[model samples]
Target: MFNLFGRSRKSNLRPPRAPGDTVRAKDLAYLQKWSASRAGVEGFVEPETIVNEMSVVFVDGTGEWTRRRIGGPKGIDAVFQGTGVPLYFAEETGYPQRMRDRIEKDRIVRERLKQRERRARLEQERER
Candidate 1:
């Protein structure tokens, strides 16, 4: 028997949490830190996908963002209600452009730093 692309036909299964299951304490702590940051934040409930768990993302007005897996949508709403900020379904609002821009800026900065480090190392080798 041959399988195309060497992929299994079995469904990838994840155990669902019970309805009464509580959200993780660490997730709550992260949410708290983001809420208390310099700028106000908005919450987005991200749905479960094949490669990722159900999670929440908080994007501050200044474009700072954090994301973590949470128990479920209800648990996310319950946890963030105390923040007094608007919460939206990821499907409804999608991700904010500011968050995307912030991530891109960080990536560029990191790449530039790496190039500088590599250049310094090459210079040191040449001087040896």
Candidate 2:
């Protein structure tokens, strides 16, 4: 591909983002907003594993949770400094069972919805 300036797209390549790349301003703002919206919540810092990148997960007493990718442990601390909630290392303290159950339930609901949609499509094809 070529650009209007007559330069090939490959020539205008940008550097790939690393795991420790700086967090975006919008993401920081969102994190602040989400934490402020909750009255009581706990933050969990999860280290980067094979399956997932480093992230921070916030959970309230009612099991409602929000997760976002953070830069690292230092970034996690800096982000949640204003929130007067406890932060824990997920490696030491496993995620709450409620969060796990909620994830599973959501997965099951999505699968069921997909199955229903597939059946509906099959029925429509049969009618045609």
Candidate 3:
């Protein structure tokens, strides 16, 4: 047997709802509906619609967190008024990178499930 050395890569997985924009199907309607009535904000670059799946992340110097679905600026604005944390665009703030990684991890999990199904089918064929 020939052996080729390769490192087994480790994966980091975080729970969806500990904090930050962890959006579910039920929450999306509210975000979309609220953003629908909002006008474009002058200085920031935002997606055309704030889908419920989208997350708004805000952090202050005091180490507190503020996160929720993309319910237009209004959602973040309300959260900010008392919280005193400023909302920054995830794309510009590098939060998008975290989001991108999460999406990639989810895709990998789906692919792994499909592979399991294929292996099960192969075993069934062999038994037949």
Candidate 4:
């Protein structure tokens, strides 16, 4: 009568939460400090999903950004309650163009560095 593919009687049927998946006080504190230090910072609320927890992305005027878990949707208000940074649902407006530009810029820079390293290695082989 053993069923290897069936759920156990005690099973709750919920996916197990990974370690560090839950939000912590330091998450809020880090967001606060990072936002305070940056100018023209804005917050975008990202909804929770089966694969990931609710989180927020803060982008500054220069397109520099950071993301952190906010526990839930309500945590968005709690984090930016008094702060001047505007909050927007990422699902509605989508990410800003500047953020995308910054990402592209970074990617190009990394590719150039990798190319230079490869050239140096080839030169070393040629010299041998």
Candidate 5:
């Protein structure tokens, strides 16, 4: 039973990877440096989707985080093999509350900075 496109349904089960989706040396280096420099870092593996490759996010104690594409699950194991960094499946265990809190805090700080800039602009207009 051929579909309208005359292709097997199984063929569409998995989408092809986008160009440059595979892991690179730079991505590995960045992940290594960031994880090594931070304290109490935890690795969270995010599954690959149509728009993105499988990636890992490392969050430090302070909630500072960085994400980089990890070729696949095996790559993740290889990267953290001797690093001693704990790894979690992001899908199984959602992101930590601290990460969320940190994001909100940063957002608030940015808003305040924008408000200050606007106020300064208004003052300058009044002076003119």
Candidate 6:
């Protein structure tokens, strides 16, 4: 039960969470409807559906937003209905290479920085 510096460990594990993350199909529909109305709103559809216990991310004129757990392509379709937005698969409209590269680089850079910072902090603490 003892932690570093002899204090009692305050859960190295994830915090206790409330049950059942809900993703209302209607909210997703609303988001999609909004995206279709906005300019420069690019939609990227993975070859398969995205699944996790957490949330589904979408973009609109207001930027990125997420709704809790809506499963499958059918679920997304429902979002379109709610939002009055059309969902287009990326494969359908050949995407610009640079834009894809830009997105890739952005994500990679963020991940790299996070790892590096974590390593650096760990190293520094060890040396102290």
Question: Per-residue lDDT of 1-128 in model 1, one digit per residue for the tens?
Answer: 33676644443445354255445776777688778874768888888776566777889987888877776656766666656667789898888898899999999999999999999999999999
Model 4 lDDT tens row, 1-128: 33586766444343343234444577777888899999989899888776667888999999999998777755766777745578899999999999999999999999999999999999999999
lDDT of 3 by residue, 36-95 (tens): 344331112233232233455433222223345543444454434433334566567554
* Residue 72 lDDT (model 3): 43
Clashing pairs in 5: none
**Each model's C-alpha lDDT?**
0.75, 0.72, 0.45, 0.79, 0.80, 0.52
Candidate 5 stretches greater than 4 Å from native: 1-22
Per-residue lDDT tens digits for candidate 2, residues 25-128, read 56567777877787667888887654455677888766678887665555665666645557888889988887788788889999999999999999999999
lDDT of 1: 0.75
Report how far residue 33 has shifted in candidate 2, in Å.
1.6
Query: Residue 44 deviation, candidate 5, in Å?
Result: 0.5
**Residue 79 error, candidate 5, Å:** 2.1
**Model 2: runs farther than 4 Å from truth?**
1-24, 49-53
User: Across residues 1-128, which tens digit of lDDT does each residue of candidate 5 receive?
Assistant: 55899987765654454234554667667877888898989989899776566888899999999887776666677657745679899999999988999999999999999999999999999999
Ranking by lDDT: 5, 4, 1, 2, 6, 3
Ranked by lDDT, the better of candidates 3 and 5 is 5
Q: What is the model-wide C-alpha lDDT for candidate 6?
A: 0.52
Q: How many residue pairs clash in each candidate?
A: 0, 0, 0, 0, 0, 6
How many clashes (backbone atoms < 3 Å, residues ≥3 apart in a chain or on different chains) does model 4 have?
0
